[model samples]
Target: MAILATEGLTKRFPRVTALDELTVMAGTGVTGLVGANGAGKSTLIKILLGLLPPTSGRARVLDLDAATHGLEIRRLVGYMPEHDCLPPDVSATEFVVHMAQMSGLPRTAARERAADTLRHVGLHEERYRPIGGYSTGMRQRVKLAQALVHDPRLVFLDEPTNGLDPQGRDEMLALIRRIGTEFGISVLVTSHLLGELERVCDHVIVIDAGRLLRSSAIGDFTQASQAIAVEVEDGLEPLVERLGGLGEAVAVQGRLLTVQVPADADPGRTYDAVRDAVCDLGLNLVRLEQRRGHIEDVFKEPVA
Candidate 1:
């Protein structure tokens, strides 16, 4: 089932159109919403959460009309905003428990759930320290912990790794993946870094200039190309010429030669041809592998 869906959704702010007839759907898994800084990713999330109304079109979250059932939808959907919104003076446990109680949990249950959620998010003794004293990674975890403390069915995580270092980013990505797979909670995560999402998302939705560019499974986004990349230690020009002479469509990409593998050509024959050409040229084969596409490729095109 689709966790969220939008059709012809657009949002305008006086001089700028943040979203322009945007349409997309997210299912039950970790879905990455990718785009540049001004691509309207945040606007879309706000509309879906009923925090912002679309200028036109329709949207639904968890089968609830975003316009009408926003209260109930917010109750079921957790959101970790991109920016820092934590209270500096409050401890993680205190903040999350307050959030849980605000979400309508009883005081006792809120406290208990907050403790569990904080621990799950990798906040231990530090959870009791003032958020102002916590590192960027710890603050992100506290934000995440509050979002999940309510036992939400789905979460909209905006730039969860925004200020995180490389190690913190990896750890957070692992947590996001675990939330989707182990906890069985659907997640819609946003990031400007296309490659980062490729590592953890089951599906990816690419947007550009406030419009949908492409949406597909991660595997489909990074499918094997018909071309194989070959890198030679030396004499690249000679190898390129030899491969071209053998009827392979070869294109030079930096130090690598990209050879388009013909559909009807035998794999073994192609390998033999490449091997013999390299051997005949006496050049060292540094690497050879089928090149794969990436989600970033979609953004390279003009907006449609």
Candidate 2:
């Protein structure tokens, strides 16, 4: 089922249409909303959350109309805003409890849920420390804990990896993946970094300057293209030689050796050929797979 849908969803600002007549259906799991700074990703999220009224068109969340069922939708959805909004002096526990109460939890339940959620988001003893002393990663966890405090059906994570180092980004991405796989909560995460989302999202929605560009499942989006990713234990030079000898087009980009799978190529025989070639060269086959296109590659292609 399409958990979220929008049709002709337009949002106008004073000088610009932040979201043009956009239409998209986001299914379950993690769907990435990706674009550059002014791509209307934020605008669309605002409209979906009922934080901003659309200039035109309609949208629905979890089958409820965005306009008519805003409160109900809000109750079932969680949001982590991109910018920092935490109180500097408040402890994460105190802050999260307040958020849970705001979500309509009873005071006792809110406190208990807040503690559990904080622990779940990896804030332990330090959760009692004031927010001002928390590192960027800690702050992000605090924000995420609050979002999950109410046990929402879905979460909209706006740049969850922002301000983190490469290590932090990887950990955050893994956590986002676990949110879907372990908890089964739907996630609609937005990020300007296409590559990072490519690693996490089950589906991707690409926008450009307030216009819908593309929306596709991750499987469909990363489908094997012209480049065939080749892997071997060793003797790369020989495999490269023999493939080229057979008049195949091949190139080495970083760790991947991309070869052209012939137009009339037999899919099953292709791997066998690679396997045989590796045996002939006395090399173990490590990885010989298809080269999947990344989300960033979609932009490189001439916009259709």
171-230, model 2: which lDDT tens digit per residue?
899989988778889999999877778778999888998888888877665334435587
RMSD of each: 5.9, 4.1
* C-alpha lDDT score of every prediction, in listed order: 0.88, 0.84
Residue pairs clashing in model 1 are none
Per-residue lDDT, model 2, residue 128, is 88
| Tens digit of per-residue lDDT, candidate 1, span 1-304 | 9999999998999999998898899899999999999899999999988989889989999999897889999999999999999999989999999999999999999999999999889999988889999899999999999889999999999999999998899899999999999988999999998777877899989988888988888876533335678999989998888888888788998998888766566667677788899888888889987654444555665544
Give each model a TM-score.
Answer: 0.78, 0.79
Candidate 2 backbone collisions, by pair: none
Model 2 residue 54 CA deviation in Å? 0.5
